[model samples]
Target: MTERESDVVIIGAGIAGLTAAYRIKKLFPKCSVLVLEAKDRVGGRTYTVDLTAANGTDKWDLGGQWVCRHQHHILWLLEELGIETYKQWLDGKKLMQIGGHRIKSHNSNLPPLPLLSLLDLGRALDKIENMVKQVPRDDPRLSKRANEWDNMTLEALRDQVSYTHATRDTFDIAIAMISGIRPREISALHFLHYSSMAGSFENLFEADNGGAQEWKVKGGLQQVSELLTDKIGKENVILSEPVKSIDQTEETSVLVTSETGQNYRCKYVINASPLHCSVAMDYKPSIPLTRQSLANRSPVGHLFKFIITYKKAFWRENGFSGEILGNGGAPVIPGCDSGPIQLIYDSVTGYGNPALVGFYANAWQWRLVDLEVRKASVLKHLTEFLGEEAANPIHFIDKDWTIEPFNGGCPVNTATTSALSFFFDGIRTPHDRVHWAGTESATQWNGYLSGAVQSGMRAADEVLTRLTPEIKLDGLLQELDNKFPEPSSSSVRGAVVMVAGSAMVAGLCMFMYWYLT
Candidate 1:
């Protein structure tokens, strides 16, 4: 087999890996860098499509469509890339559905409420504000507190709020759908962290270009990844080459055969793959016990995005702004004008004619994906909230994260109130020549596209620091291999058994909670 070399080798050409490669080349032009991607394409989870229309417009955006004003990394990148964004339209009547009843209001000032329930929600927001203020953005304690909250289910929080059955159902379903995790499975702390980052519910609802402040790239989001790839050159960025094993030896550092039986030798390796993917890949010198353990425990978030094309933004014609929120229930709680995904937005500026993007989370989606009878079910739900006309969308597309191979699931950070000190402190730390960078490893915007870029940039910085004259990369690689040897077959079996047992226990606990609670 042919052999190759580079100053640094990064696995996975997702946003994180691509960003790191670009930044490293910029910082140290003399250093040789190589990026190996499993897929033939770049942009891991960011996919954008251009659908030519009959009216000379195109429908698009398959992934990563929105950016908030507060998301500095993405905003800055767009500015640097010379991408323009338009304000999200928020002018007109908003719609809300609850218990199968649709409430239409032109007033944007206050949330419709049964006064008392609204007051309770206000009190809850106040408490959340206090919680956010107390948690520092960069504190080490953030992970610990987040874990603690993870242990307490969302149901527990609902209980604390003393919500009525209807109110509890509405809030729980809405929050679960937004979070993409079952209310009972998600930690309250993680929920709080999201609130803190978003600023408030109102802030989250207020879109920049439209609802969710979503923007379509004038060309496509793919342009961002393409720009970075152009800077790195085609030779250095290898595609359709997935790294199967990373063998670190005292004498030589080798990347074992990929699916195509090819190997690349490198002095240092940066693992930008997601935590679960990292676990699946073989490591000759082996990863740290802490990192392995965390990988086994990390929770995967479920997020689904669907795009529908209509002849026009018909809801607008009927005096509706196309934002809707609802409980998990079909007629009422599942639709929202702007809250629980009853939120439909205008996708005409960058893409084609009238298009609507729908997001679903938690059990609502779980049930939706499983139904043998899908189209009718979806139509029923849409018709209830979006009128009978919405039932016949011209183009329909959906992305199921669970079914994706490269990505086991949608992006999610450490659970709130769960012990993540080890994950952030030990697992994410650079070990000699090996470094970790992904959305999960980021401190800010932990589970977003912004976080992935930030983590990549930070990992590149760390690698540059280690490559300084004061530290010897070759010597460090040797020490790493000597200290961490590959496990024997018997040991591998034992480890697998241990992981299986832990998974069983965790599953049992989840089942019991679901059954009894």
Candidate 2:
């Protein structure tokens, strides 16, 4: 077995790992750094491939594809790498399949529903936004209702706040698209924290005007990581080396062993993979139970993303925006068999090739199904919503994050019900010389590419302080601060008003009950 020594060792060569290596090398040139990745390629969750063989000349991103102006870290990194981005196509009307039968087209961001259902959805969203403001980004458990919120499932909250079936179904669809799981599986507190970190809950799904899906990189999102690897130097990164164990028993250094028996000795170690991936490794003396429990409880999102290339943009020609969402028809209740597809968007390639990108509703149900069967279902659904032209596509490609051994799944891992309240401390707290650097550990944009960059910078700074005591991290610290800004006064006042309004309503109800009795 080969042995090597470095100032620091980073596990996983994803965006976070590559960013940490780049920051360390740029700031402290003298410090030796090494990056180890289990996969043969880089980019972690971001995977871009050329579609030339499928009658397309442009590259397609099969994973983690969207970004917006508000995601500062990802935008900043793109600027640093000289990468360009284009706005998503949002000029035409959008279509929604209601009650798994009727198709409706609308120009607004919201789907067409009954007036009462819309009002209920608006009220529920406002209440959720207010509650989200009450949760702290640093430690959610510190909030007054943390335990209460964490103990309750988001599904239960939905049922309580929403008055109509449409409202409840809408919330379920949003949850499925954002988290790849049903509302009942996630914690209310965890969902609130996730939304708070993303700047607001609405920003999580909006496609236009600075929303999360507002833009796409010119070449592909993966280019950012590839460029970062170039800057870090290829020799410093070793691929196909899955770390089997980490031992920090020695006072001066930590030892990391790979599946191939190769050992790496370093002063500090940064784990940049997903939470579950870290849990797979055997650690000397074992990590804290809180951390273990957190990893054990938190599960990766099951997302099956696919891209279909067509000769023409038929939806746009039909005055349709190429965006489609289906929730098993109008009263859109949540069920595993709702449909094969959940959401889709116009994904014209960088070279101007027409394409449609989307995800499946229930990944587990379709993960093992025949590929042709899945494709047939997707085309039939698209044709029913868009037009006969949707049935024909020049090329098709897809990636199931569930089948990936390295990542387990894509988008992000979520905190299960009660997991955050009981094990929040273990999410980011370092143990011995080991540091965490995944999107899950970030304070802002927690599951996006921006979060990955922010976490990498934070973890690298943690190592720098110990490696070089005199190193000035003023710039790095400033960037980190921008990511975890304090809540606005206006938001706090809104929360207060919401609380007072609830109290007044309860008192009036009690008074009416007493008089009637």
Candidate 3:
């Protein structure tokens, strides 16, 4: 094994790992830092690809892309790193396809379905908004209803709600695009907890000036990750080194071994990879059962983040905004089985490159379709919405995270229906000297860039505290990882499960009480 020593070793050279290394190095210049990445690239979930158009070649993010002013951590980092931002274009008419009808709207609001449908949407939103505040994100198991909600998927509850067909379709699209999983695939509490973390469900879907879609980095988001690698010194960030195991057998330090026989010994480790990838690494003493079960059961969402470049912003010239929402997309929620794409957005930059970004629902059927067939179907679908002018793209590029080797899926990974309730606390807790930091472990914007940065800083603080031994980092640590209930003893895996279809009426009724006051 090629052996080396460093102050800290981070696995996964994505934003989280890179940010942690950058922050720690900035604070303690003398400290040695090493980052190991499994993929051939640096940005974990954030990937920037180049496409040539009529005028010139432009860049688009094939992974996690958008950032809102509300995402404070990433926004602050952009400013510190000297990255600029541009507002997303939403000035023209936007289209929403539902069933056989097409609805047009000039704003980010839900489509103008029938009055009954609109009412259904409003009620569902209000009820969900109220319930969001009550569920604690750090440890959802502590919530009285956690055990009950985890037992069933969101689809089970959808049946009970008196939503108009249109409203239901809209909900499915929004949810699937955000988490990359069908509502029926994830627990209701998982949905509620995510909504709570983002402050509201609307914040997850809106493209308004203050919504999650507000602004994007001037260059591709991958530039941010690349800069971190540059700042930490490129030699220290090793790519294509899939970690084989981590052994902290001795008391003084921990040893990390890669599949290529590269060995690293460091005082502490910041495991910034997703839970799915982290669990694959062999740990000597083994991670807690609670964490192990969560990793084993967790599902990485599948999504196609694709972009089609055009000679010009053709939609804009035709008086149509480039935004397209597939509300009436398919009978199936998110309509992956029924349609080619669930959502489309304007990918035009300040530099005048014209393009349309599309996200296809990760349906099992979609994956089964041949790549050429998928591409042809997408182009045909665009023709129906944007006219024959959209029939051909100047350049076409798409990435399905499911196919990526090192990185399991895109956007973010999610907890299974019953996993979060049982293993929530262990998500960010340090196991001996091995610390965890990833978007999934973040507090504010879990699954977003903001969350990745927040978790990275939290892990850095943890390592710094242990090395210093004089200062109390608990306060900062607590703020980063929200205070959740800890297991009373080492017998970590408890027999706690959420009841299926058990608490909808009761939870909503409780919310009604808050609504009345």
Error of 2 at 303 (Å): 1.0
Write down the TM-score of every candidate.
0.79, 0.91, 0.88
Ranking by lDDT: 2, 3, 1
Score candidate 2 by TM-score against the native.
0.91
Q: Pick the candidate with the highest lDDT.
A: 2
Instruction: State the lDDT of candidate 2 residue by residue for 1-517, as single tens digits.
Output: 7689999999989999999998998889999999999999999999998774234478889988888877888777888899989999988888876553577787767667665666676678778878888888778888899999999899988887888887787788788888887888888999999988876777777786566799999989888888998999999999999999999889889999999999999999999999889878999969988888998988888889989988877788888888887674422123345567778999887678889999887777766677887787788778878878989888777789988869878788888888998888888899889999999998888999988998898899999998999998768546645754443333322433455466568889999999999
Runs in model 1 deviating more than 4 A are 52-59, 99-106, 140-150, 165-167, 194-216, 251-257, 331-343, 361-373, 413-417, 421-423, 469-517
Name the candidate that leads on TM-score. 2
Count clashing residue pairs per candidate. Answer: 31, 6, 5
After superposition, which runs of candidate 2 have C-alpha atoms over 4 Å from their true positions?
Answer: 53-56, 328-336, 483-517
TM-score ranking from best candidate downward = 2, 3, 1
Number of the candidate with higher TM-score, 1 or 3:
3
How does residue 363 of candidate 3 score in lDDT? 49
Model 2: which ten-residue window has the lowest total lDDT? Answer: 328-337
